[model samples]
Target chain A: MDAALKKNDKQLTVAEKTLIDTNLLKRISNGDQDAFSELYINYQPRLIKYCSRILKNDVALAADIVDEAMIEIWRSAGSFSGRSQPSTWIHSIARFRLIGYLRKNKELLQDESSEWLNFKDDALLPDEEIVLSERNRDLIKNIGKLSDKHKEVIELVYFRELSIKEIALMLDISENTVKTRMFYARNHLKNILSSLDLTDFG
Target chain B: MNKKQLKKRIPIEALKLLPWYATGWLSPQERGYIQKVLSQYPDFRSLLDAERKMINVVREDKSILDKSCLDATEIRLNKVLEQLSSTNEKNKKASKGVNQGVLVYLSNLVSSCSPKMQYAVIAAVTTVTIALSFAFVAPLLDENNVYYPATSGVKKSNNNLTTLLVGLNIEPTDPRLLKILDENNAKIDAIPSKSGMHHLTLSVKLNATQIKSLLKTLRDNKALFWFAGEEF
Candidate 1:
């Protein structure tokens, strides 16, 4: 698995990895609809994930935030500077949009823990249930069991790839608190994985 | 650097930062140090893989609706882009029209009169436009304008005191109608009627006796149909 992932990662040069988005933005500024489409296709899913993670997988709300952000991106594509990675810039934009969304709907975020209670259960397709390996499927099932605080840290750190500093600022917590939560999250995740199977921990 | 400094600088806690390393969020020197540590420490490679695997697993699980969301986003973004494009086009046309109209007005004003007459020109244009609009709408609103079709033919009549009954959709001017007036030397005129029907006219020289004969002929004429037993 490691070798396969390494092979995939090696296909893109560092320059290609970092500069392709910058180049896409440059093309977009010239009123290139194709470039805009390409960029939207790439960013939309990731932004949706980011927004939904906070809104606890309210996909409709997530989609709304993403679409609004995309409009703002299209209108201001010319103003993008390469001071930060494209993903970072986009994450910031999505973050700001989420902030606005939450400010408007304070009630939704109040019960974030309950928002995704049935999410993983519903996300499973019948074919995936048949075809996915039991271990990985069990991992997904177990991820849903973690507490909201631990799950939030794990998702923001490992899945979203947000820096601890950024996550701290977003959650209005200290950096040490973020790190402490990450440590507990990793330990709890390992415990969850170990509980799924015996041989790995042994 | 001293051996103590080198040992202190070695990145032991970098194992904990593997997720950030994978994300490329670390500074260049920190990344290099972490790389060096991982190269020397084979166990940490597995740790990195495990972190990477967890990231992939979580991302995969969270992206359950990626295709549907992407499609929704594409449709929405395209709509927004289309709206922006059309609005920009409309604004461009409107501004262009305004610029051209202002230029033409300025040129006409410069050529037509002194600066003192500019307000007069504008007032005249406004008044004429209002009058033209009123005239255009008045015909549509009036009842009088709805009538008055010269079904027989559209023509003016010069002979005065002409009377012709529009008797029940008959042939407009049958030969018998003129035969009744032929004894009086009736002159059929092509002049359009000012008030109403002028199907046939008799000269005054025909006098009352000829008129009586013409009336008798019209009353007994089989070519005419009398409705309600009235002398039409």
Candidate 2:
């Protein structure tokens, strides 16, 4: 049984994932419409969800952000460097497009309080795992208290699974700056969760 | 090492490194530093644990995002494919039309040149015949006092010859004749005929030299003339 489980667990490694994604990117770069379509089908759902979370569950706006990001992916797929994971690279693209959408429509972001409440309620319910539930509720609440910059870093690096280097490139900031924002964001979350009585939740 | 040194550490300013640390992404040195610090401070140990949990929660949320985004992307891809197909069709039609137009224009051009060349050859032949006829016939008519067919009843009376009705057919419209008449200070009576011909009765006294000069000028100018006179 252990051997069977181990075999099942031996899925594609990170390097293998990167290789496959890179191959797909290379095909896309060569104007292979089928390859590009495959990429779209593979990543669009994740991108839309990321945008929705970042943009505070504005589904229509999230859809627009996802569309814009995919269009950019289509245009710039030929330039994909194997320097990062394909998902990380694509997450960065979605983040950038989401920020632009938010900035362009500031009023939508201002009305995001209701969306944040929904996100917080929904976030707390997804994980039945005790540790995950406590941590998720703490994060959602603390994220609402963060500055836009700090929240952006946390969302990209932690939530979106982008590396510090990838986040730096996408935000057009230094790696040091990304680190600084992340550091403060974590500290802030820790303080916020501490005030919420971490033992009671545990 | 000292509590003073530890207090001054200020969370490594590189606490930014914690996100990478939570994900087990740190280099050995960085991880060692963090571990050394965490061992020294029990509070930091708990903080690191909390940070890892937070990162996990975020990762879970992100995973959900992945699935939804892919669904949205499928719809977008379909739209793009539709647009590309339409553009390809339009481009194909445009190219076909351009090719057909070019072929038709070339065929018409090739066909048109032969007829145009034929017309040009006919025009050139007609021009040359006219030129030669004028050169030969003009001098002969001018010397013989001939009346051109286009003019009738215009006559020149010759004193040395019998008083026969000597009708000299000359083109009254000719500039050379008009100039000659003007030079001699002569007048002629012009009568218009129904056949678009003009009849002129000359009233000028002409010596042999003047008559010869007038004939030479008319011949040089290619004025046509003919004789319509009483038969002897």
Q: lDDT tens string, model 2, A1-202?
A: 9987754544434345557778887897676888877776666654554565655443445665676777677667865655556766666566546544543444444434323311222322211222332353333333335556766777776656677778889999998888877766665444334444442111
TM-score of chain B of each: 0.24, 0.23
The best candidate in terms of lDDT: 1
lDDT tens digits, residue span A27-126, model 1: 8777787888877766665566556666654454566787788766766676666755565556555655665565445444343422322122222332
Q: Give the runs in model 2 whose Cα sits over 4 Å from its true position.
A: A1-11, A109-202, B1-74, B84-232
lDDT digits (tens) for residues B57-83 of candidate 1 = 556665321112123445656876787
Q: Give the CAPRI rating of model 2.
A: incorrect
DockQ of each: 0.05, 0.07
TM-score of chain A of each: 0.50, 0.50
Instruction: Supply the global lDDT for candidate 2.
Output: 0.54
Task: Give the alpha-carbon lDDT of every model.
Answer: 0.56, 0.54
Which regions of candidate 1 are displaced past 4 Å? A1-14, A109-202, B1-77, B97-232
